[model samples]
Target chain A: MFLESKRGILFVKPMADVPSLTISPSSKESGEWVQPSPPRPLPISSLRTLTIRRWFWWVGVSLVLAVVTLLTCLGFGTESISFSRIWFILVGVMLGTESIHVGTDPTAVILLQVRLPRVLLAFFVGGSLAMVGVALQALLRNPLADPFIIGISSGAALGAAIALLFGVGISVWSVSALPVCAFAGALLALLIMYRISSLGHGFSIYTLLLAGVVLNAIFSAFIMFLTSVADPNRAFGMYAWLMGSLTGPDFFTLGVLALYLGVGLMVLATQAQSLNLLTLGEETARSLGVEVERVKKLVFIAAALLTGAVVSFSGIIGFVGLIVPHAVRLVVSADHRLLLPVAGFVGGMFLMLADTVARTALSPGEFPVGVVTALVGGPVFLYLLTNRSMRVGM
Target chain B: MVDSKNVFSGPAYALRDVTFGYATRAYDQSESVLKDLTCSIDSGKILGILGPNGSGKSTLLKLLARILRPERGTIELFGNPLSLLFQADVARRVALVPQETMQVFPFTIAEMVLMGRFPHHRGWGGWHWEDAEDWRIAHKAMEDLDVTHLGSRLVTDVSGGERQRAVIARALTQEPQVLLLDEPTAFLDLHHQLDIARILRRLNRERSLTVILVSHDLNLASQYCDQLMLLHHGHIVEVGSPQDILRPDLLETVYGCQVLVDRHPQSGLPRVSLPV
Candidate 1:
């Protein structure tokens, strides 16, 4: 009665104070729809925050770490350079000051040729993978939608395996063919998953996920069988690469990856609005006059290119792609436009830090950079799933 | 330009031998949901289609939206083949507020409402100032529906009634010539039911839009719609003013229940009540 009177009064003259929109506590109305509110703590926001607040911060950390990782790759092993003399060696090289040869000859060669390229490769690959993960998460609107979980990593591995067995990846890629072949393999797997999942009317996320799981299993089986039968020498290289290494990459290869990943990241960042709209489902996307399918294709292709390119070179570095974007989204908000670039920068920083740890952790010896990424990322990914999935999915 | 001089004064939509079915599998189009159903909705009038569960009210709406193509028969929109109108073009003619829908992501009320202008927008850059005029029209609609304050609220955060209005705001954003709704007021309270009906009535009177909606609440439909289509087992059995359609025997035959039919004091249309 009291509510009726208030409503009656407002019926004549609408109030400015009340929220203009309100749905009643009318459970009798929803015939069957009783969707329980899910848990909260959206990854998109955190990533958005990380993307904004931490981009420069992470980049600064990355910049210092880049130099340190590069130097450490020279010094930490059997070829250790002094902390003090390393600076001048770098300065001498940069300035063409041939007179200031403060360091031993072996350390200088190690720093300039071997360590620098390897560290830089880690930075580019890590950053590219992270950005790809972010792009896929936004495009698929599923947090679990990373390259590894959805089997994209295995796809690249399978491609690399096929190429490696035939010695064709090295031939076709000239220098980058393994990476290129791996990328193609990943794209092929993802496309197959997409085709299987599309049920004619519209794309269902549930179907896409189910398809990923099945395909991943199949690809993993094929890879294990292939690995189990490989020749011992090639198998050692394959296993080491599968675990992921930033131990030794040629400088020319690193530069090419840097350039390619840079272009991929830029393309993704520009399509942020379309990706953001897509998070709301295709009907809403369509109602807005967006060619929903076209945008999906573009985002998928870009993310695939990113994953393929990074994987082709890095040989499947795990969880960095899965965790970095999520960690970034938790801070920023679900706005993909900001999320993609921020994820890219943070991704670079994360890989650089991981490689530094990989170089330092088992010092004098080395662990693969991919192993360190899993070591860092897996626990973080698990924590996020338990704590924030409800909010992220909602 | 449409030949306005020869405009038909009858129902805006006519369905002849329409059939449809849910896709249980890739090949299962056999058990048609709406088996050779036929119906018509006249222009500038609020027509309500009422039936029991699975009686094909929703299938009828989807067929009209062309979201589902009928297995057979023609659905004429504004007395023209529905196919002649593009999905976007028909979207401009009729806007829909679907039932049992939930959004998984956040979009602001204004943004959701602005989506309605899609059919009107041209060129690839998306939403122009003239589209802003559509926004203004949507704003006016939100104001009239008492939902103007929800402009900035995220559609995902709001309650059902608020969400419905935002959706209607979306449809209004389309600046549609006709509106097709599937249970628009299902989750709303009594006041909102009246509020939605009044808004539809106003749009009909002001714009001469052909408003075809499927509603479960016979009383609300009785109070609002100019005509009512009583459906049973995939067929529209009767069509008349609410007075003719809301009679006790007709309601009983259609719903398989006894309902009290009395004159509403306000509008003098028949009010339907379930026997307690």
Candidate 2:
């Protein structure tokens, strides 16, 4: 019937065209399909469900990955040392057993002070970035969406550039101001984008994505101008940051990042249900009793905080935020219960792994982790993008 | 579980001659999306809004949901003005089921459906086993929609028709006073469309749930709606019971197409046919 009526019937199946008189429409439907059903999360109710227990697998793997990442990061650096000595050195540092030197005095110090901090930063940053990826992906409702796409990274860079070059005299007690600057910038950009894309009625993702690209370019240009005008010394520091390094940031910065990341992560994770509804779009989300705007505001703040803090301290570590969330979604589905946390774990491990390779790929000189992320993520992302499943509009 | 009479027990919803428009761009001058639109909904009985494309069907729904601020009007939901309710408070009374059915994110059906409980819920925890009841309600909604088997399957992997039902299931999980569905059957085949129609009918009759649906399917509207509103160029063209409004003249004026209206043999509801 379809082929007879339409000229552009590119392909047709016998069953698709012919519904025989003998077979009723109701009878043709073999399965007793459930209609609009309720949400049932990963069943963790009993030990019997342990094998299929997805969270347990993530937790078990995360611990092992974290430990291995820690050791490998310490083991290979400017002066490569044995794995045993690296472990002993780490134990000594933890236990305050400062007497065991495995080889050169310089290598031991480098292992303890230089490599260890960088590696741990990678792990923690990875974890935080991935989790933020999950949150932002759910919040935005576009798989291609990320913290960067929303202009959070650009805003953070702007805030950091002003602080570093102009030496914005925010006192030590207002020490929280540096990251707060980044978070504020992110929130401000997000507000503008939201307002512009959603004037009245529903949001158009194409318009939003286009808006983001324009905003990103504008901010990137501004940052470039800041770099060009700054003193040579400041320019060098800015260069390191723009390329994204895991080098600087003291423990105080870590403490602050942890605090903000913790609060944001908790908030996003708790609203996992809303995030789930959001994937169905705003109207549906609201009907499901989600305070759509409030959820939007909270998730944006959380995503901005996560993105802003990371960019402020570690500089712009690109692709981890973009890649980690997609990876997690493919493996675990968009159910935020698992998606949010797993994105974090996977992100942490991925960054740690990337940073480990970056630091050791060439012993004396260091490579930027962003390059590694893009190199790894580009191919994988391409595969997902061109896949048959996504051809239909979401 | 909600009683219909209690919904408008003391004047639940009010919209006072609101006007909305978009600013002029280079190509087009300022234009109104909703022109002096004034309407109110009672607590019970599903309200069906029928219109052609670009006729402000979505604009009307957005105003009610408060996602988009109306340009020049006052909207009151359940006695309190829209401005009076906290963001959370408004969400408790109304829920919207949007049109986009294709889901890119692979949310499990359970997690997707539990989102309906967000207004009734608070705080920021990942998933509390203690909130097991919310999960149960979501599961029940899924069952009500007959989508229980697709619970574990990635939402991305499902058929378009199945995904649409899943989205509606999520909305049902919200347990709202009013349910607003925009193009609910836009993505479904005939079988699923009828299934949704039946489910919606049951919810309206049994629960007294107020349903406001924006659809292109005039037949479905005539069959299910207590009231049918015709819209054209962002204005309500005609409104009344299906029998009164489903005339050929108004249908042509609003839709810009030839339409034939006939009475159904058994139900006596208006049935519509369009030109090929």
Candidate 3:
């Protein structure tokens, strides 16, 4: 039945012509209506289910891939170490059998002390950023949402710049102080954006996004002004950090980062089902028994925490958060329970590879890992936008 | 399991002096959408709310679904104040099928339907995963809605009528005693509209589900609803059976347009039409 109005004419096909609405046997049983069955199911392949077993399978595969990527990237720095030696060193350290003195052997020192910590840091930071990306995207109901675009990274960067400008020494206190300041900055940004967006009772996604963009610009200006006024020697270091570098993190720093990321990821994981419901719509989620306000708050804090933790140590790495989750969603289903873990592993692997290239591509002189991600992420983002099959709208 | 039909002994919903308004930019003033409404909806009955645009029909349905709170009055569900009940508790008894929803991700129809079981999950930690029984109920809802074949299809990729069925299937999976629909047939064709009406009637007969729907289709409402209510300017103009409420004078006043009222030729139900 076509509907014609003064505004325009809408030609709706007759019910008999629409295959999806064809009368079914069950409906026919209720009355005298008889119609042909719906045509063969659309040729599109059915979406793969993430059963408990399949979820575990995919997670295990991604975990193995991440570990392999870590180990492989460890073998790439200035002084490349053979995989066999790296494996031996790992086993020796774990089993406590080989008394390989790290100070005496440069290879062991590089593999265990320098390279090992760096790779592990990369993995944790990457995983944290990606997980937060997935959460933020779900929270905002925008697939493009990520820590960097939403200003959390710049907020952390601003905090770190202040700490450095004040000449916070590299003592144990400074070690804790830098991250504390960054986390504080991230929380402040989160609160400000949340307040601005939620002024009308509930969050408006457009308002939240606009606030994030504006906050990012303001934070960047503050960071630039601080850097310009600081000493050139310190300003150089700040510049590199602003560009997002993962440089020389120790085991203690890695452990602390792990703790923060662990807590944040656990909080996000517990809200996985709620996240799935939220993607449908806030009212729909509320009707489905989800506490929409509570879930939003929890996810916001957790995402801020994860972003701050990673940005504090790794400076502002871009694209791992935005790209990894999106790519994983394409391969796996959108079920947050599976998407979260899988995206984390893939992100870890992605950043590890990017950092490896950054460190090794320029010989002894290394560039910021953020440069590599931006170079790769920029093109990939464009491709996703232009490619019809990417379907990145969500 | 106990039958939900036997669980509730009184009216499904009762609103007393219920008033709702949207706060405008002016701090001291507000625009009232529903004003001082008092009504009681019986169980196991289909109630259709009819009104012109902006008449608060949808707001009334939302209030009954517990999705909105009245500004100055009380709403009771199953003899208990709606405000006193937990959100999940309210959801478990009352399910709403919105006219449309924005889908940010491509969730499979089965996954979408399984979400209806969310209110049934136990525990405050939010760690509950859907078990076999949840899947069974979801599957059964799909079968009942004749959407079993669309289980693997994405809700975003389907036709409007199919998506509507999928959404209704999800609502059915909630296994609620009362179902609230906001313009369920607004965008549907005649066949699909009839299909939806039949499904609602069947559910009402089988499970004693109380259905309250808001619609502009006067003819469809008259054909399906046992009780009809007309509203104008946030006030209830008339509430009665189709025959009593579908009078030309009442509809003309509520809708602000002249309408010809006649009986449906086959069913003898009230039929409304615009006299061109």
- Candidate 3 residues lying further than 4 Å off, grouped into runs, are A1-34, A38-48, A98-101, A167-175, A195-211, A385-394, B1-5, B26-32
What are the per-residue Cα lDDT tens digits for candidate 3 across B1-276?
Answer: 233446678899988999998776543333548999999999899999988888888888878777777899999888888888767788888999997866656567777888898889866424566777877788788777777677766665678888888899999999998999999997788888998999999999988899999998989899999999888889998889999999999888777789999889999998999999
On TM-score, the stronger of 2 and 3 is 3
Top-lDDT structure, candidate number: 3
> Quick one: ranking by TM-score, best first?
3, 2, 1
Docking model 1 quality class: incorrect
lDDT of model 2 at residue B175?
75
Q: Interface RMSDs of all predictions?
A: 10.7, 8.8, 7.5
Range of the 10 consecutive residues with the lowest summed lDDT in candidate 3 chain A? A1-10
At residue A98, what lDDT does model 1 achieve?
Answer: 37
Candidate 2 at residue A60, lDDT?
Answer: 68
Model 1 Cα displacement at B130 (Å)?
Answer: 12
- Model 1, residue A393: what's the lDDT? 33
Quality class of the docking in candidate 3, CAPRI style: acceptable
For residues A105-191, write the lDDT of model 1, one tens digit per residue: 766777777666766687688778877887777666666577876788889888878888777836543565666677788888878
TM-score, chain A only, candidate 2, equals 0.80
Off by over 4 Å in 1: A1-124, A173-184, A191-214, A254-274, A327-330, A387-394, B1-18, B26-32, B36-43, B71-94, B106-156
Candidate 3, residue A85: the lDDT equals 91
lDDT of 2 by residue, A333-386 (tens): 456766677777778889888987887788678788877887887776566566
Residue A69, candidate 3: C-alpha displacement in angstroms: 1.1
